[model samples]
Target: MHIKNKLSVAIILALTLGLAGCQSAYYKTMESFGYHKRDILVSNVEKARESQEEASEQFKSALDKFSALTGFHGGDLEDTYERLNDEYESSEAAAADVRKRIDAVAEVGNDLFDEWKTELSQYTSSKLRNDSRVKLSKTKSKFKKMLSAMRKAEKKIAPVLNVFHDQVLYLKHNLNAQAIASLKSELSNLETDIGKLIAEMQRSIDEANAFIKDLKKQ
Candidate 1:
């Protein structure tokens, strides 16, 4: 197969074989193949950031659709439902991708820090060892904060998704102007929740960007 396809297959297999559960063996294998923990950590963080960006857009699109639906005088309700449902699915997938990437980043980060600490113990020079230890501490602190922000953002997703799910299902049952009017009544609360979700997502995205920049500079 093509090189890109080969790489895609490899990644799918890696994830399927329990990237987290077998992380020790997985890391060893990747390292033997010349991919180190640092590379994985950076890549995963980028993936998480991308996912967050997509999720943000998908959510905003869904909100826009809802707003438009409220003002909608007439339209094919089935078509609108399908569009919103598609947006919800896309958002759900994006959220899942972000979580996966964050977990991968965390796993590699833990391994990298453990190895750094172990190597520090091996260093005989007090000044050099102390400096390395200090840098490691700072990196770990930043990573912890980033992970916390990411998890907080992730937590916000489920509630928003639940709201979307309810709206979608309700629409499926009552796909008419009357249903639209009923949902219009709910638009305010929905918008409020989505606004909160978007804010959390933006915060996490900013943290991810900073974290990625720091890692690159290291």
Candidate 2:
């Protein structure tokens, strides 16, 4: 490892820890290490896509567990409630991660666009400045489309979580076959909601991939 590269790594690590709450400082430090905002934006988009994928799977798993309650055959109701509660909690965590990743993408994207727009004034060549400006506009347009898709998917998460939370709370209080039977009635609607959520997440993931590819080409 080159000494310069090693030092850069160390500095990045220090900034990551010390400036965890200071995005501007962190981005500046990263830029100093040759990782400009465009690169960071691409990386964050990849992360957001992966998070959505994971979240989709987690929600599916939770739905499967929830659907299982419909077939309750008089076993340990407490155990059953505990399992469902765990699934609900896991889904919540996954949703939070998806939101966090999306926020990271948005932050880096905003910074990258702002920097690009600001730097256009520094270009003395009129032709080159116009070219850069056009590229910036195109990139911003694509990013907005992708971000909108991501947000639409994110909005679907809350309603599903709310349903799951309600069911989990009901089960926790009334750990009986009757309670399970009651929940069984809601399974179809829950399934439909989850299906919509997964579909929206897939759309978002696809948009992210398309944006990443387009950005890399530029």
Candidate topping TM-score: 2
Displacement of residue 58 (Cα, Å) in model 2 is 0.4
Write one digit per residue (lDDT tens) for candidate 2, span 14-132.
45853468777777677667777888789889999999999999999999999888887888989988999999999999999999999988977898899899999999999999999
Number of backbone collisions per candidate, in order? 0, 0
lDDT of 2: 0.90
C-alpha lDDT (0 to 100) for residue 78 of candidate 2: 91
Lowest-lDDT window of 10 residues in candidate 2? 10-19
TM-score of each: 0.87, 0.94
